[model samples]
Target: MLADFESKHSLYFDFAGARPLQFVNPPQQLEVKAGQTARLLCLFTGSPPIVSCWIRNKEQIVDGPELWTENTDQSSSLVIAEAKPQHTGYYTIVVRDRKSSAQHTLTLSVIERPEPPASCPVISCVTASSLVLTWSGPCYDGGSAILGYAVELKEQGHTEAGDWREVTDLCTSTSYRVCAGLRHQGEYCFRVRAFNKVGASDPGPVSPVVRMEQRVSAKPQAGEAPKRPTCVTMDSSNKVKDHYIMQEKLGVGKFGQVFKLTHKVTGQVCAGKFYKGRRSKEREAARKEIELMNYLHHPKLVQCLAAYDHKPEMVMVMEFIAGGELFERIVDDNFEHTEPASVHYMQQILEGVAYMHEQSIIHLDLKPENIVCVDTTGTSIKIIDFGLAQRLDANTPLMVMQGTPEFVAPEVISYEPVCLATDMWSIGVICYILLSGESPFQGNSDTETLALVTAAQWEFDEESFDEITDEAKDFISCLLNKDTRRRMCCKEALAHPWMAAFDSEDLATTKCLSKEKMKRFLARQKWKKAGKAMLALKRMALLSKGDSCSSPTSPGEKSPLSPEAKHALKSLEQKMQGPPHFTQCLEDQTAVEGSSVSLSCHLTGYPDPEVVWLRGEEPLEESSAVQIEYEEDGRCNLVLAKVSMEDANVYTCRATNNHGETFCSAKLAVKQ
Candidate 1:
């Protein structure tokens, strides 16, 4: 067979001198500053007519503006011009022939510190014993999260550098209250410094001197009558209840609850999203979503009818679609799903996405659950859920770390700048699942799923894609490319061969696709969603109850701890005795290669704390080789079945409850 193939196509191969591809000089990992150029060169030995290609995030690279490639028979070079933070990721060089292939992978890190605060700190409140300071965050985060702020204080009339002292090394929030060392009748100046993974930024401008006195008051002007205090009230008639009659609950979301509603005047039925929290921050976030939805107008997109601000709560009226979600229809026994059907849905999704892109909008969350049908027949489709949608312009680039792990784009997982291609990646995943009835990147846990996405580890399984056409697979591959630059845009995807053949009268288009795998996928998604929703609601309730621990003792039966303990015991005393605290923290350990290892810690908190294990910044989830155990008596353990060099890192155990949260970290060393 080999001789026959070589004889037939002798021009593309050298059968006599062919050698397996080998990398003589593989590319090395790189660490470069943003805006700097980076180049990766690889030299290899292979048969004649060897082909070399560059890939990043599973996407093949070609000669382009930002990224360009140069290749010869046995060598390749990938040059990244004016590399930005978004370009930080893994890059691979592959040299291959008809019979053999060699590849090398390397990571590129872009380092930069966040900018200082936008403006000088301001004094929000001044009291006799404490001073409250607030400042705006930096305009640019330098491609990483702004972990916290550092507050520094300098007493007035002090010129020496030693006069300035640190108020707090880490202030997670933008506002900080200085009550511990502040003294009455003292004057001080404050400045803030923002920090991220890279390091702390330059200190912002110093604030105006704040004079703390025993009392602050202003006297009325002489010969002038004192003005009466003005009062404002909300009109009861303006409440959402007065305009709409809320009906049965439809669904619950992270930030709000959806309900079926009917307009009182028009008697038109619609869906209303009522924010779950009455706090000002939650209401503001709800208002932002509603405003964005109302501003966007399209047939394929859900429309926001009206918005109502009823005091501390916000309600948004949305178009009510009778048909269920996209996946629900796919899993329905009565629904006839075929290659053409999947294409039909994907075309509609592409059209909606194209419109959003034209309007500078990117729907960060574009999963099967967010796409719904117009009616039971499933002819028309509407893209719902704008909770994570963002608008990006020429000047503003958004970096976010929030999305469904299974469908998130590689850049999102890396916290890189998001582009229109980000949504296209999710669209590709959706298309893959629509035709195959299986998710390409789903794993046993979120951590694993995210790892799969970052690596772009997916393939066309024979079992799932046996009947799938090459055109369909090509379409999905174009969108799922890890390199956002190479990924297809909405218009390009809509113009793909598979989508163009939506109405074709062919076997591949007419054949019914099996739904067995899809049904299972739907069931698994529902189960996971249920668990997450329950946890979120529980956490919300706990947080809303304030930062006080519930006592373990029942009323009138306390033997005694202290008056402070008795006072801390609120209404729900049976749930807990006191706030959570750590009895012991994790310690550094050493283990041999391929050996089982366990890290144990002791925790004691009222109302049982929720524990999370993390390796570096990445979370560790329960898997075949990983197991987590906790006991009623505050015993916690993390077990690893087979340890490897990759397991060597700083491991952290974070425990959280309504009362407070604490964490401890230790290093793990693995030896061969």
Candidate 2:
């Protein structure tokens, strides 16, 4: 059983007055002429004294060449010599004691001469069919008030004789816009002069001649003409033809034609793309090419200098690479003797591909023809033809089949959802071609190539590639894995032992090659270790079961008991007892002096009981002195601080929350 009760009480306090205080009279306003001396003062009175200060703008005034200050029991003053506008604004006087402070505000105004207005220069000019005039204003002279300004303009090659227009109503703070109607297709020069109330200054130099073109309006007959559909024109005499200035024609492909062009201005060379305009789809393809070039920024990717959108014609300017495509270098030129350089170049290509994937950009087309050496040095490879590039956001679902048939992943060929893994698969095919100089999977026709991709059927003869390193083969195998989940990503492929060989010659010749072979042989061994780790985790989870097991706690482990655990235990115990009830306080007391005091008691029952507070033997109510604080779940607190003798008896606390109730007592002691 538990006893419950509540009570209330009142608390009060008083303080004794100290010694007599003093009053100070602060200055109302302090006026100081420029280059003159001025002093600020404050007066006060009191016994034993007080500290005073000269405060300016709520901050203490310090002693300097311009500002000198002194303080005493009678008054405090701050002296200022050669006071300027910076010395203007408000000042203050402050007096303070151990317990309180007094302050006053004083306005300090300094008289000085007005600053001169600065001269303004012409900032910019815009030419329309009409305007051949210019305007000017001031920057900031000496801050003097500007009354107004004057304007003037004259044609070029004309002597000191010309009409000078004067507009007196001009604001100094802003630039002036001058518009003078002039003949179209004619060049005219102009100059502007500025003036202030003080006087007019010299005129600024004349501006260069501005030639405005005449505006033409469309006639009814011209508007009736049919609008041309944007297309890629093959004729070399078009608008872009003059810009590109084809020097020589490169090899043509099913996709488009590339031509070498020399920029007339920079005298630099570039490649111009001229897509075949036989179909409407070709026009759409032209836009995709420009979009791809604008999004990709990498050293290894082809740089798009400019794109022309002439109706019924489109052209893309790209960096001219004389080294040609990798396919031509390896197959057409027979570069087996240059195998090392070729392999290194292929590694750079893979690096670019990896970077594209990391940026969530997919280069759907990956082939040797798209990979070209960008410079005569043959040190850089460029990935071109981004007509099929697509961005993949983090949440984008993998779907829709895309890319060339032969390089497409198995999922993509089967019309299933394909992700960046599909790109990796294409890169694997590219790597295979670069190392072996032969397509890993090819057919007599496009239909056959796609069939092979769908079936995931590709032939790789170790005998035919005996000269090829095992490390290279392992990397390709990881990327071409049939399962997307197990397939090696672009990042993982770049970190493979085969790619690592590019960094170390010794590793390339020995360790990486051996490691690749060992990996193939010990594939099952790694899986066995993974299996053991999983089993161990499962057994540990099963062994830890009961609530009172008192499992071995690791260092710094917090209490394993949860709030739900305590709730469950309390519920069970309360069922063993009966309905809950409140408890009464046996006694209560308060302290007259001190900072903190405590109240305590014991709670007993089948279920762990809670404690609450009360002033007297009645149910406790909340007030400033008595507080019913709570701690961890199911634990109640009765905290009383700043104890006076009034708080010196037993305090009652009733704790019950669906659990059986219990009463607790607290004894408080007040210190003198």
Candidate 3:
């Protein structure tokens, strides 16, 4: 029979029908920013679906750093996270089975940073009301072409102080004939800067101050009035849309939503706060914030690295200061930083503010929420949110009400001119909260809060202050003084005696808080979560009994729980000051087809461990046959719902933490 089949070709029937056709649909072309996630999707259809293998620029991929693969009944995917430029190039996916195979290919391009321009502007001509500027391209294009240039002007002898004010719209060409807005007789200086799709380049040297000379109206000099370059007022990063990849959204407000952003090439994480330009007021705030961050850089300040303008939406890629908000530490019951620790944190705050003031940038909004711990140690702090920051001179009058009501200075509430002193006032309030964990001006209502801030209606509560020191009180009073003249600047605040002691020897062992206070804080934080969990369970129990929720499913509906569900909801209520133990074991369980069985045990331990249910030495994450869940006090349940023969196995309950591990195992026999 084999010899006869080998001899015939055209006589063969439709065996295995269509030869198990496999079709692959990879993207024709894909573009992703560097440092973002890249996903390659491949799908197939046949009697027994497709098995796939992925290749990049010709090398087969495997489970390794930055690469992963997942497959389902009919689809499969390759995911590369924190993708880099080296990951770019040709990619191919081959889908095959016993009878047939097919392949799909595509090109991936990862956008990266362009080089900053190298040329400084040349002053070609100058007149009473205009200046003509010309420039050459950069040393490198930073992987992209130069898109535009920026022109700014400032007075010759101001405060080393005044920020450079952009005078032209982003010019599309190398030269811009700066027309209009020049002082007729006043001395002035000008500078030129360039930008590309990636980001802005440093500005070239400023032109020497020149007294404007009148130019009589005459026949235009040949090529004098060249075509004006189409200039846009927005930064190049804002105009060009593709440089950065938007990742997860973090929050939303009337200002706009915030997101976690990653720089495609560098893989740096940033907070992208989107300020909706849907309203003029909001847009102006966004622009001001960008302008402030553009020039300011300091260790204590949250750096605004880049800005993107997705029209009607503006995004700022800012520093991802890791430790979370200062308020969290304030509320943490376990946070028991003594006077020495508290003083160290305060000193850093003042140091950061000093840097900001030195740059002539005033953070109009200063509060616990706006400040964050930059490092895990929680000692290093960073100031965030320049949306309310302004480049104000001491005499610049503030006109609007901004900042948290609780932290706003008296000068802000009165609509008086805000200066560095205004921020110092906020620091005083922060100092108060830091020491005693109490708000100095917070009230029950917005009206009351504003009133308290305006009137400087705050005092050191005697009870809370007894544990605080006189030097600390003096430092707070000096900064919080309603009088702006005596208000301590960042330098003076840093020099305060209370802050000075932090630098003395033996500060760390000096204790952050009084012994009793430290213990109370730790106890407060540890038990709060456990207590809340207990309260929720009680409410759930009462609701379930009242509603008769234990009834079986009527029909065509999925049951809320399996018959074997170990609803040991009451087990975790007891506090565990002892080592974790197995109160209940798996204990040979028997269940019928389509029924559910649950196995659970109560664990007692200090500091909960990661609890897992395993089969032999293999830990189970989750599956259609089994699931794992736990309660606050360390009681965990392993539920095997919809029991089938495949569910038969020995299950183990294991708890592991920094301390050690404890486990209990039992068997389950499922009958079909």
Candidate 4:
């Protein structure tokens, strides 16, 4: 029976040693999440069954609950279950047979999952149609940090019950709203859950049924905020030029400048906001802007078509509004704003604001500047700038007062609880200026203006309002009321008599703004535009000078490899040779401190190789002073900006491909 088995399975034996016993294949590098089973296998030639053992860090491993061993005549495997970080590192398998013995090594990496949230999230407040939820972080990190949280809602009464629908929006903030897709007066239960890399925990204990119409006033509870994704950083490798043709910069926005970009295929124009997260708040603010624009859709709002999370920064592409700011047309060189036109603008503004409020979004910054004109006709208005926006219950006291001072409400100045009425006050200020061409709360300086605003000091300028009607004055007064509760919200303001006359024949023909008023408005706007531009320029200068470690290549620039390097690589494929081999290996080099130098390597081999310039195993950072130059012939050079003692290291130029890899290294010395 044994002789018959040997005759049938002769492929496993090396008869007469036709080929020397050798490793046909060996285990490769492995990566796995913690708690998962990891198995490494190695194949050998000519074996009845080789005695094999697994070793980590030179220590022989033993079989147990977390580890097991398996072997066949030709191959062997070492298995590790419930792998942990300690299991990570270099591991080797030694195999011995009657003919010969072989040893193979590989690397294993186990990633640890983050722990669940330290504490459960709490419900902050609820309004007629919205429910707000907030949470703090988990006590232990587990291994990975918290990525984001999900707010789930379910109706209480059910036999089998439906699945929980997580709020599907881009926001990663501790505070988020569940107003959409909800019935106005229905009773719904909510649960807040947090998740990390490994998986999610069971939803926190469910909450009592919340009626949609229930009104509650509350502030953000004090707690340890979760480690949310506040910043999305980037490097020189992130580029947008491949698909976009950047045109003129529109202007600086709340977080960064808005650029005019045209698509490569469609040739369509759009405004793109490219932001670098220098501060955590800046990153959070940018994230919120994207989240708000992602789900909002209205004729009165600038549409965000798509967003690109291009590492190093986030790029938001929005529908381009061509005409520019509303003030631009309202203060045109030959501007004439008819009362009907002003009414048209205001109607659109209120409709936009009404829609925003319906969606539980508070436009904290509302002013003539934030409103944009769709075209030169002043027919369409779009609201822009949402830097200070937030989602809150209708009556919640927002202690943080942030908005244009001239337009801020008295409640804001007193550091009291603020609500949607704060936005109404700003709108009122905008309307007052639009009708009278004189700021109702204008003062000598910001301090005096703020003081006057706090006192709610303002009156109709007799000369400016001589021709204005009482209905318009009444509409403005109701919104400017210091008692926020008495103030007319967008819905009520849109129903005023003056607004009712917006479509009348006579009113349509009467120009609301005179030539003298427009000229002054235009001058002030020009100054503001100039001031904003200067500020943006200064910011750009600072960003460029801030990172001195390495100067980065312009993301827009093309590769700078030399033609010779290109030729070498192309010729290598045609010429018969082994894997990439270095022709001129790097040599020891010395440089004077503060002096510049370049190190070059000449290489040739089959299948063009990708060469990485490195200091030890660390890749180099491209900067203005230090650059890596390449040629088609596989020649690579490292150019130093200014060599310093700190720059001394063992420099290496490693080239690799499918077949094999070759490297040439040398010591770099910088003298005093």
Provide the TM-score for each candidate, comma-separated.
Answer: 0.48, 0.39, 0.42, 0.45
Stretches of candidate 1 exceeding 4 Å from the true structure: 1-237, 506-509, 530-672
The residue ranges of model 2 lying beyond 4 angstroms of the native Cα positions read 1-238, 253-256, 276-281, 331-343, 393-402, 506-672
| Residue range with the least summed lDDT across 10 consecutive positions in model 1 | 224-233
Per residue, candidate 4 scores C-alpha lDDT tens digits across 1-672 of 433532442111112333344567465678778889988887876433245666664456767887888877577788987788677666766655444445666778676654434334444356667766544444333334355566777765643446667765343555567768778887777665556666665566566676777754332122211111121222234345655688998887557788998877667777788887677777777778877763345578877655555555777667788888887677666666766677778888988887666445788889787899887764778998776777765345566546665677777666667776788999999888888777787665555666677778899989887877787888898899886756777767888887887564775467555646645755664444433433433343344345323676653333333333333333323333347778899999999999998898886654455566677666775779778776533467889978889889999887775678888999999899
Q: Candidate 2's residue-wise lDDT over 1-672, tens digit each?
A: 124231122111111133333454446777666677777777765422246555553355667877887776567787887777667666655554323345555677665433322222222234454431223233322122234444555554456564544433363322344454555566555544444333555555655555555322111121121111111113333356555467788756555787888765456777787777557898787777676554344567776666666666677777777787665554432333233554576568766776565345677778666888765444577888886777664455655444555566777554456677777888888776655545665665455555566556776767546776777777777777776645666546656787655455543343211123323323422233323433432332233223115665553332333233333333333333433343333344445586665554333232333344555555555668657543322234566656677666656565553445555565555657
Model 3 TM-score, all chains together: 0.42
Per-candidate local distance difference test: 0.73, 0.54, 0.63, 0.66
- For residue 492, give model 1's deviation from the true position in Å: 0.7
Clash pairs detected, candidate 1: 551-576, 552-576, 552-577, 580-605
**Candidate ordering by lDDT (highest first):** 1, 4, 3, 2
What's the residue-level lDDT of 631 in candidate 1? Answer: 52
Which number leads on lDDT? 1
TM-score of candidate 1 on Cα atoms, chains taken together: 0.48
lDDT of 3 by residue, 151-192 (tens): 777876664635678887467655577777777776677776
TM-score of 2: 0.39
Per-residue lDDT of model 1, residues 580-631, tens digit only:
5778889999999999999988876654556777788777767899888765
